[model samples]
Target: MTDKSRKPVRKAVFPVAGLGTRFLPATKAVPKEMLPIVDRPLIQYAVDEAREAGIEQMIFVTGRGKSAIEDHFDISFELEATMRERGKDMSALDGTRLAPGHCAYVRQQEPMGLGHAVWCARDIVGDEPFAVLLPDELMWGKTGCLKQMVDAYQEVGGNFISVLEVPRDEVSSYGVIDPGKADGALTEVVGLVEKPKMEDAPSNKIVSGRYILQPEVMRTLENQGKGAGGEIQLTDAMARMIGTQPFHAVTFEGRRFDCGSKTGFVEATLALALEREDMAAQVRQIAARLLRG
Candidate 1:
């Protein structure tokens, strides 16, 4: 799967149009992507991952009430002025701005599906190969998941999806990959099955919501084929491109927290807080104290 003739992945498309129904009232006014794992929002982690992967432009497929996401990446004049007056260090806000042209927002008008959300950004993505990062899936590591995928994409130059081995029983909640051959972290993806029953799953390696896809996938999504819950599933579109192009998966070499769920969110909060030197000791004490009750 070594084809280096493909275009460099410069832009990243973030599908953020979902209603975030899983989070309920917390997400009623706020976009799920805005929910903070610690001090940083989920979308910030995703944007940072894309930036680390050398992605130049960010295409956010957003919906109504998603303006906070746009605001998150934009420069706030008042806040900066206040920080300046208060003699606060501005270094913390250094990576917040994406420049003007670096960020583009497209509206996904309806609650379609991941495929439709991605397709909504087609015009912005153009003909070049691009990356996709699902913000809710917080992938933490020394080298970000998208960066790892980009490195693999450079060698393989087809389509790469970040994967991680979950338990077989948990496969029903995710898109499982039918593996062909494995070479270290990279595996030849023979097929993709979206949310298969546990007994029918091909492998426990579930798609981890980070992707480096060729532009051709946009064409497949344009057809709007429905599968697995009668929605235009992205896995179905990627599955069609399986043999036609090189499709592979990188078993992510990092911790992933599914921030969309309450338990996963709490786990991520604690885990990430424990990573910070400033918060680790206090957080550990708080956890120990709570457990003693």
Candidate 2:
């Protein structure tokens, strides 16, 4: 789809209310989304992706002990003053902070599920279609994954989700979608099964933490019961909206790192560091040595 055809996705909701139980000790004090992928924090990458997709109103659905996540996006007067005094080139820090009224934060009282966290932002999202991004899923591409999905949303006009193929053996770990017809980069979702058994999986397509959902989804989620893990599964709610509204999965050409996992977090750092000009030589040598061993 052409750039002009891309409908402006003005608002986006970031669900940061999860208790990072997987990364225990580190997560005890610091929110997992605040953890650095390489240089930038995980949540920053998500915000960058949303901005790339033309999102204007950024809403963060957070829980307790997540002040750092909010502070990261706020202007640090002392830090900025110090950088200016030292004549440091801090342009990279420019877009990190949000201006007054441009951002909003709401608390998800309980760690219910992705759907519940998203539901918390319903009033902010209002009646328009809004984008949902899970910060833990870090995607790398020339154009952000959400940008691609936004492009597809413009053409399809219902709901667009970013999808990728995961191993069948790993199907039970993710929300898998049954893909129907293939239309260019878009795939029609026939069904959505929340982490089905390996043999029961309809297809290999997994929802990769990015979505462009319609306002109607809020109603479905409002009355939706708990699904997988006794949590209000967002996939389940979105699945109900299927056929009633058009749902398409945009297969992005990119690398996705599940930074929610310890292994995935390290992998993302290694991959990004290996690609950087300053770190490439050292990173390559270490990788080569490790391979030799």
Q: Please state every model's RMSD to the true fold in angstroms.
A: 1.5, 2.7
Model 1 residue runs over 4 Å out of place are 1-5
Model 1 residue 105 lDDT score: 97
lDDT per residue, candidate 2, 1-293, as tens digits? 33422446799999998899999999999999999877899999999999988899899999999999889999999999999999999987967889888799999998898999999999998888899999999999999999999888877678888999877899998888898999888999988887789999999888899999888899999999998789998888888999987889999889999898899999999999988999999999999999999
Candidate 1 lDDT trough over 10 residues, lowest sum:
1-10
Candidate that would win on lDDT: 1
Per-candidate TM equals 0.96, 0.94
Candidate 2, lDDT over the whole model: 0.89
Residues 1-293 of candidate 1: C-alpha lDDT, one tens digit per residue: 43443789999999998898999999999999888888988888999889899999999999999999899889999999999999999988877898989999999998778888999999999988999898889999999999998998887789999999998889998889999999999999999887899999999999999998888899999986687677788888899999999989999999999887889999999999999999999999999999999
TM-score of 1: 0.96
In candidate 2, how many Å is residue 18 off? 1.2
Candidate 1 structure lDDT: 0.91
